[model samples]
Target: MNSSNHSIWFYAVATVLSVALGFFVASHYSTSEPVYHHAQLLPQPRALPEMALVDQQGKSIGNNLWRNRWSLVFFGFTSCPDICPLELQKLASLLRLADASAKLQVVFISVDPERDTSARLREYVNFFHPDIVALSGSNTELANTANFFGAAYDRSVIIESKLFSVPAGIDMPVNAGNAYQVNHSARVFIVNPQGAYAGSFMPPFDAPQLWGDIKQLIKQ
Candidate 1:
């Protein structure tokens, strides 16, 4: 073949190969993950960020506290009149349906550290179920853990509004007056045995659905 023709052919082959490689990489990266109804795997499950908090026993707690068993974690305060109670009640009911020796743990992490002392939380959790673990931490630890789970809690600082919202056990911050209240996300995060976020269940939580999902994860 002529030199000019050979050169053109070489360039064409290289261009075609480059295009193919690009398409292959794009396809691999753009593939959508499977959708799970209750608890599914993340495309890339991230480790729980470092945390240092206290448990219902006032014992130091963090990610290590979650290492051994499957944990269903909720972030709220005992003073939360409705949402927290309802969620824990549902969780208790679900646990009742499972074996007492099941390798699952329900954790209630307090967002309002100022009020949910270890003793208070211990008494509070018992009202729902004896097995439930109510956890708390310093404000910094609580904030870090919440951020890892995509939850938020901010004490209202406004002094003179007539809005009435506070956790059930907590009085409004006196310095902030009546407008201040604690606000946090209402979602339960499921952590698998590997201590990775397996999935999450948001409210309007159906006990049957949660049960089914938990069963699926257990068997897996």
Candidate 2:
């Protein structure tokens, strides 16, 4: 072949090889990484930010609370009209469906610190599941913790009829003047046993799928 022809052929061959290699790497990755039906895994685990908060028992704790066990961290408030109760119920179902050997913990962080005292959090969470850990703190502390987990909340929104909006036959014990709503993120964060932000599960969770994903991560 002429010099120019040879150069073109060489470039073409290199392009083909590059494309093939890309496909090979992608295929290998797709097969090697655990297929999660629900959870969205992060590209890499992230260290959790420092936080100073109070637990349900009025005990002072921090990010270290997530260490030593896999945690499904959720952010909400005790007075939330809908999402909080639904998610907690889902977590309760997950705990029931999970294997006894599963080293899993559910952490509920209240964003409405002014209303959701440690005592109130304790009662609210325990009503759903006894094992759930409820945490509350000052606005600064709660904001820092929520931001670290990519959660967001806004307390400025007010709904005068929020108290009356609860479904009939459902008793939601709200503190006096708790007629406002705090909009918050609905995502549930996943923390590794080492207390690192690992991944997250979006809302509308399916207990079976969530359990499957957690089981897979537990084995890893």
Candidate 3:
């Protein structure tokens, strides 16, 4: 072939090789990614809210707490008789099965700080797993964190009190009895090492599926 034709042929071959390498890399990357059965991975990660919370020891934990490691956070109150405990148990199970090097942690953020004191949060969360960290904050701080996580909770009300509406400009009755409950989302939030909202494992939780997802997330 002429020199000009040889040069054109070489260029065409190089382009074909580049396109093939691109496809190969993409396909392998996709296949290597762990498939999640029950977890919902966020399409776009979100920045975690700036926070001011007290740990079980009454130590202040700022936004820096969300940094350095993966956090599995659940929002609920000690008074929640069922869902909170059940969800904690599931998380505990996943922790047991998860890879030891995954660098994951669990957090219980109380929505009822009026009742869930730092000591109270510590006791409640530690019952589920010794590694689980409990957090408490003022009502405004708690509400802001919960709103960021898409967790909703109503004001504490007496267990036996009838459903009543508060008039505009009125505040929720804070003296709700010991049996008072703060309804909240049972979903577990995943925060990445960079302190951003990563993804979550929704209700009807499966420990094995969560374990698999956790392994994949750590790889990410």
Candidate 4:
């Protein structure tokens, strides 16, 4: 071949090789990714916001508590009539299903700070799972933390023997005299070992499916 013809052929072969290499790399990485059956993995992990909260043991904790282990976090209150207790039970089941060596933690952040003191949170969560970390904080602190996770809550008020409407799907009895309730998000947030907001699982949770997803994430 002439000199110019030789150069063109060489460049064309290089381009083809580059394209093939790109595809090979992409395919290899894609297949290696863990598949999740229940947990929704984020496109990118998000950093957690600074928070000041107290755990059930009255110990001060913050974003650092999320580091070093995978966490399943739920937002609710001690006085919640249905969703809160049911979700906590689901988390307990997850912990039970996890292998002993699984570095997983369950966190319950109480949105009803006025009623859910550190002591009250301790008793409430211990009933469901002794290892569950129950956290309560001042309204401002709680709001900031919840907002970071996209969790939301509101306190129901009793006005002259009339109970304000609770969130739909929450069953609050009319005769809950002088007892107010909290309406909050039921989705369980997931935190990676690096303390990043990784993903979430929506209720009604299937314990076995959740376990499968968690194991896959742990392996990754």
lDDT of 4: 0.84
CA-lDDT, candidates in order: 0.76, 0.83, 0.80, 0.84
- Pick the lDDT winner: 4
Question: Residue-wise lDDT of candidate 1 within 1-220, one digit each (tens)?
Answer: 9999999999999999999999998886545432245664555656787677788888887677678788899988877868888889999887777765557889999888777789999999999889998888766667777777777666655555544444333444666533345777888988876778766887777667777777666665
The lDDT, on a scale of 0 to 1, for candidate 2 is 0.83
User: How far off is residue 199 in model 2, in Å?
Assistant: 0.8
Model 3 compared with the native: what TM-score? 0.79
lDDT score for residue 55 of model 2: 94
- TM-score for candidate 4, please give it: 0.78
lDDT per residue for candidate 2 within 123-162, as digits (tens), equals 9998999999999887777777887777977754324544
Candidates, ranked, TM-score: 3, 4, 2, 1
**Candidate 3 residue-wise lDDT, 113-206, digit = tens:** 7678887878887888888889988777877888887877775444355754332122356555555546667788889899999888888867
Worst 10 residues of 4 by lDDT: 167-176
lDDT of 4 at 93: 91
Q: Better model by lDDT, 3 or 4? A: 4
